[model samples]
Target: MALQARALYDFQSENVGEISVREDEVLTVYSEHDIEGWLEGVNSRGERGLFPASYVQILRAAAGGGAAGEPPASRYANVPSVPPPQPQVAAAGGGGGPGVGSTFCPPPHHLQAAGGGGGGGGGGLVQLTALQHQASGSGGDDDDWDDDWDDNSTVADEPLSGSGSGGGGGMRFSPELDGPGRYRVSTGAGGGRAGAAAASSSAAASSSSSSKSTATVSRNLNRFSTFVKSGGEAFILGEAAGFVKDGDRICVVGGPHGPEWQEDPYPFSCSIDEPTKQTKFKGIKSYISYRLVPSHTQSPVNRRYKHFDWLYGRLVEKFPVISVPHIPEKQATGRFEEDFISKRKKGLILWMNHMTSHPVLARCDAFQHFLTCNDEKAWKQGKRKAERDDMVGGNFFLTLSTPPTPLDLQEVESRVDGFKGFTKRMDESVFQLSHTANEFARKQMVGFKKEYQKVGTSFRLLSQAFEMDQQVFSVGLNRAIAFTGDAYDAIGELFAEQPKQDIDPIVDLLALYQGHLTNFPDIIHVQKGALTKVKESQRHVEEGKMEPQQADGVRERCDTISFATLAEIHHFHTIRVSDFKTQMQHFLQQQIQFYQKVTQKLEEALQKYDGV
Candidate 1:
């Protein structure tokens, strides 16, 4: 895809060599290894090298690309742009790039953004006219938006995975608001104007019928300008104003979630004296020891492996969309060592980071219950149930009614192919998972004593996660397929003489969900087949029905499948939640276009009938 340098940039990397790009200089985009915050492009002089992905705005998307579309999203990270800078026409559509797939490939040097997507949507879902043509896109390739797990990226990161906030600085709107390349407002609207007055005084994104009507246009522009300004009231007016925080200020002060850590009780001291001869097995003795430091009048609550394990399960059940960071692994040994306790403490910190990072998980009363609940028995009985609300992950930070900037139609399609590619990988993942389970069913059955219980629980959790993934992919894929078809059908109504555009937003939202669906039927379809092979292999080994050579072959096959499954799961977990977030952002951009169009249409009607 073609891109214009929004700013002057000169880059030299050991991998790609020296290349200088001037502001407004148009160049062809090749690849966006955007996770590392760079772009791959060739200047008009044929000098090709890695340059800052943030330094360019996608003037034109190529035939296929990866990542978020250009237009109508983050202003600093140019994912989406405002409609025409005029009519404010809502562009409700997505999935316009090539179907890029992810691979476990080595990193390319001199990180730079890649190219793809052209003019508009390729498999454009929205066509409002008689001969509706699919919009071209900036081009998406066959690559999926990769997760940052294996990537020890030296550059700044984007929020989530694919279709990050766009800047060519390529970023997204995130809660942390502190990542590199993320945009913020230390100041407000132009000239550091206050929210209300600036909006009242200025005109933005306005249109005029004639030069004589510029003043009227200015007034309308100001009305719209109010919403787009940095730190404007429009962004924060609707934050559940009546909802006060659940606990007292003193409650959250001690850890990453808050400061102060003064109130809650953490296990202070746990020690086991060296064994003295007190057992039948002579010379073996066991005794419990603890020296409690006195501070509060409140009684101390000592938690153990079971309590932590149970809490982990509860977190997994409720926050399926968020990845729970690994807890310190359960060990039969060191149950009472100071070093072990310190390790557990570190694990708790990591766990807290995971829980607190997500908006929904952070606010969970159950999470609070786990951290601050005094009596383990009473809390488990009374407070431990899934906080499974459908409203989880709602963008409360954003004004629900406000529309996002509309993205170009083509850029949207390129994104679809990217999602589809990810699904394909998921399909492979599922087959591998099924195989691993069946292949290892025998080894898993032969019990390793003493630690068997813990091992068994770990396996159960992994299996549950695998099943959960399959369910997520299957459900999302089916719904997406249906909704996308419906969205396509909805487009026909746009051509009606009296357009019933109410369906546009619905269609746009549907398309948005469809684009991000993680299911791949190709792999889903093969699930049964893969499992059958594994069970067969296991059966052959168990019954001794196969020769030694054949048994070895079966084991080898299972081993290969198991390895692939592990890799696939790693990739899947790393970015699935991020993809959901990305999809939602893109959807809002489409909805913004939908709202603007409807608002304009309504206003035009009011003008004609003098309704105002």
Candidate 2:
């Protein structure tokens, strides 16, 4: 009987003498090739060539009586000519191949035997038999099976010594091989190496190669590998020569003298209003669009919530150290409801106010684009430009002009630590305040309004009872009682309306600051991480592992992060002070007006009873 094997993976011929084989194709094995990882074979088409031995599983070994052109008994000694194991479906987590489970359901076409249609349909679980050894003279230098197989391919019942490479002297097999043996094969999308039993008999055959393969996979999977692989240009370092332009405005490094701002030459504010329902793709999709009119341009632009969201992301990416306030949250269902729309509109208005007031944020190219670009093409161009900006992250610090004198490193660290502590406490307080104020607003809208209405109802009932009396003296008292009832009803309306003017605005302001507070800690961590690197470099210099000049370069890079962080901290404090003062003043004024209205209504009701 002729020795035959089934191709477990598709093999494209890299060399002229090698034949290409599709996955699941069967080929007749002529003899073991002179090469270490290859085999001489004839495919279904009768085209003779050499193919990788690792890509196929042995279907049948040559008969005991040696025939001409057959591989010697030493190579096929362990490979029995028993019938192929029946296909079995096992659960996915059963111990088996590297990254693949023990059982695999081959496609219907794969289950069909070579020469004729085999039994069983697609998705039938199949247990692959032992893999053949790789021959060296395969005509293709790239046909290294040791590189494809993983080290974790141990048989569940019988453990194998070597990683899944078949380069040892002879084939190895379990003592009780007649049963349903635990053999693993690659069921990956394209094709992979076989399991533990396929490894070389010699334990040390491919140990070094296996380690290299494992390390390559681990390095590729790392999250920071992209930045490392890109030569540190992904975030764009400021020191990266030729990337920074001369005219770019660099942020001034903050020190004991305090932070300085790059004043906006053309300061302006923007108004967001006129929310209207919008549709696209012939109304298949609908959303709300808000009208934005900036004071600088006076050119109104329409934007949806998603546009604002996109701009917010760009701002955060460009200014990692700066606290970019979050926009209103997205809603999936009931988004078109009147109440939700109104609430979201208020949030966007508050968000825009902050964006316009901050000198740095106001001058941001992305913000300007969002506010001023009315043309669709111009808006898209501006968006893409902002996204592709190189001056971001640590590179953003490179854009800053430090003080003429070097900052005291100790003082800078102390100041940063203090600010980090302050942000934590401030965030906690603001969160508590926001929750309390929100709860109070809810009470004013429901609880307080109900209480006032209840009082008015009782007074009106008393007035109605008094009206039933026909005495002349009671008439004046009755009219006064009715007036008092009306006054109470008016007071109830004020109670319901008060929150929107005072408490609600206060809550919105606190919420915005809450977002800023959360962002500060991350910014501080980035600076601290840079500082740690500088210390490590110094230590390396002391140990003779690094040069003094190299340590100085590390310190210089550390300064960039520190400068940006300190400047951002100073800017945050300034904005916080101004914002609180304005909001408190407005809140007090609203409170006074609300109570005054209530007092006047009560006095008018009192005058109706003057005679009585």
Residue lDDT tens for model 1, 117-236 = 211111111101111112111111111212101133233222322122111111012112223332111111111111112222213311111121111100011222212121111111
Model 2 weakest 10-residue run by lDDT: 166-175
Best by TM-score: 2
User: In model 1, what is the error at residue 246, expressed in angstroms?
Assistant: 9.7
Which one is best on lDDT? 2
TM-scores for every candidate against the unseen true structure? 0.23, 0.61
Model 2 C-alpha RMSD vs. true structure (Å) is 23.5
What CA root-mean-square deviation does each model show from the true structure? 35.1, 23.5
Q: Model 2, which residues run further than 4 Å from truth?
A: 1-242, 253-257
Q: Evaluate model 2: give its lDDT.
A: 0.58
Q: Note the clash tally of each candidate.
A: 94, 15
Q: In model 1, how large is the Cα lDDT of residue 378?
A: 49
